[model samples]
Target: MDGSLKEEQILMSSERDWTDLPPNLIHLISQKLPDLRYFIRCGAVCKRWFSSILLSDPPPQQLPWLIEYDEQFPRASPLKEELPFYSFVTGETGSIPIQESHRGKVYHRTGHSYLLVIDGEVISLFNPLTNEEISLPQLPSRFDFIWPVFGGADPSRNWPWHISLVCDVGRSRYLTYYLDRMRWQCFDTVLHKTCNWDGMLFTTEDHGTSTLVFDAASRKELYTIPPLNEETFGFITSYFVESCGELLRVSLDYNLTRNIETYIFLIYKLNFEGGKGQPHWVKVSNIRDQIIFLDHLTGFAVRATAGLKGNCIYFFIEEHCRSDRFYNDSTLWRYDIATGTCEPVPCPFNRCSWFVPNLR
Candidate 1:
């Protein structure tokens, strides 16, 4: 009792305010906080707390946004029931239905915050940040005979807002949607008429449907490449082609049994622009089987299978006959275009596909 009383009396003689604490100590508290919303609110208590906690980077343990799906291809399960997004961030898998009245599935695009959806007969672009959505009225049924391909460019780059949907209703009719002013422009490609336009729409090797592109500045038709690998219609797939980065193509190989195998692969680089610019596709990897692809950026040929949404390119590091185990533990590789390198990525599922948006 005497010792405790003496220590307390001595400490009371030399005291410090909360502001006297080091910035590191304040930062550690913010990291230990359970939620960002609460941590930010606590910082409002005083300037010392505000500046340190709100302005500085959180500790490593504070980054709670990383969501890892370790089971590559475990089984067939609905995302709503199996891997709900609500439980993903909160660690409590629950449903948070969006009340917005819209049809069609909302998917996470390459840009994490943005969503791309086809709402009913109309196409829509949404940004959850602004809590705003832009929907286009259905195109005239006259042009409904043809399918529409939609996409957006990085807004900061001044890329023209593009909507290209071809209609063979009359002569070859081309319609484009421009967002800068929110309008649609139409052009016709009749053999006798001049084809004055801005961008071109075409398909690529494994892409099931066509791709539409518009020039960023001029808002003019660029070029259209068709997805020629698949013979079926309405089977659209996405591709990513970068001028400086390696080009990767992911597709599927299906035989008469309807059993499929996934592939991840890239093509060899072939310069075709006379060394002035990027190369052009000279030959496909599997021309005979019509399973080869030529990436427009690198002009390399790759033979592989398609993924769920062009998220992965699946191919075996070592070839095996059908008699062998189909899904063996052999090393499977996924090529990252951003890194310009192809490395082995472990896959744990029997038959799974990765969903990646905006490859092209």
Candidate 2:
């Protein structure tokens, strides 16, 4: 009789309506969600739950979503109609719809949550998470290839957002756009890689032998930091990322010969107040409580939460092997900064970009 009574109570509780829960309790539960996807799903349970989630604070740290371009899609289909985002935490894929005006456009690059898309001569910034689109003025002439670098936003400046468009012809040229001004300015210098830090734009040339700093507000070159004379035998790629109120540069050296490939990673932090009041690179072995996400083009850093790992780099490697013919293989890898070790992580897409989703 006691067992039967307990069973009946359990059945009644299982059938209870979850929507009747107190809003404060629901908000607390929403705050405990592991990631953004779960938080979004929790809001979909009911209208009351959605209201509670809106009042709750999201997770402080978030892992970036991998946005991939589907090669299997029909060539005539609009590429920007929908984007597939893969989550590392859940190991699941989800689709986010693009705005109707952004359809049929091609994206040149991605920075954080924003996509730099081009339609004919017009360029626009689209945020898939928020469904916000801002169109820029048309370019003077359309280029065959465009490599765009986002300088983020500075509310203190006259123009808040800064974008640099590098036209790849025989020689590289830069075209900068100011958001508030709604105009473009052409620069004659050639830049290899660019990143934004503390309201300034940093550019590298000649394989990062030197770094040029440009004031995003004034549109003038501030100063240049001398190169670090490091010798290695393979192709070197450098990435600049800001983390923990400081700027860092991560360099990857790799050699592909025959069927074997070797990779080495080195990290350096920029010290603004060094000896004699000049900025210089300081070699760093560990970056505590921070995670870095990198691709071939750009990279960014984020704080690590309980669900994420810190002092490591999450990047992908595209391998080409020539056995009978030529074939390509892509794999995601995690490199530990302290141990100098690398391990492979499973990824569904061969080519993807790291997108940090934001509700704002």
Alpha carbon lDDT of residue 129, candidate 1? Answer: 25
Candidate 2 lDDT tens digits, 1-360: 699999999998889788999989987887677678888999999999989888876655467888885564311113566888888878899988877866777776565667777777667767777777777777777766565555432211224455666665444555443333566755545665677567677777535478888776676988788886777545667888767767888887655552222456788898877435667788898899888888655677777764777999998774432222322344577888877776767778876777777665
The model with the greatest TM-score is 2
For every model shown, what is its TM-score relative to the native structure? 0.38, 0.83
**Per-residue C-alpha lDDT of model 1 across residues 129-233, encoded as one tens digit per residue:** 243565655554433333333332222123344444434455444343333345555543321111112233223333333333335335565545343344432
TM-score of 1: 0.38
Off by over 4 Å in 2: 10-16, 55-61, 72-80, 151-159, 170-182, 206-208, 217-221, 258-262, 274-276, 318-328
Most lDDT-accurate candidate: 2
Local distance difference test scores for all models = 0.36, 0.69
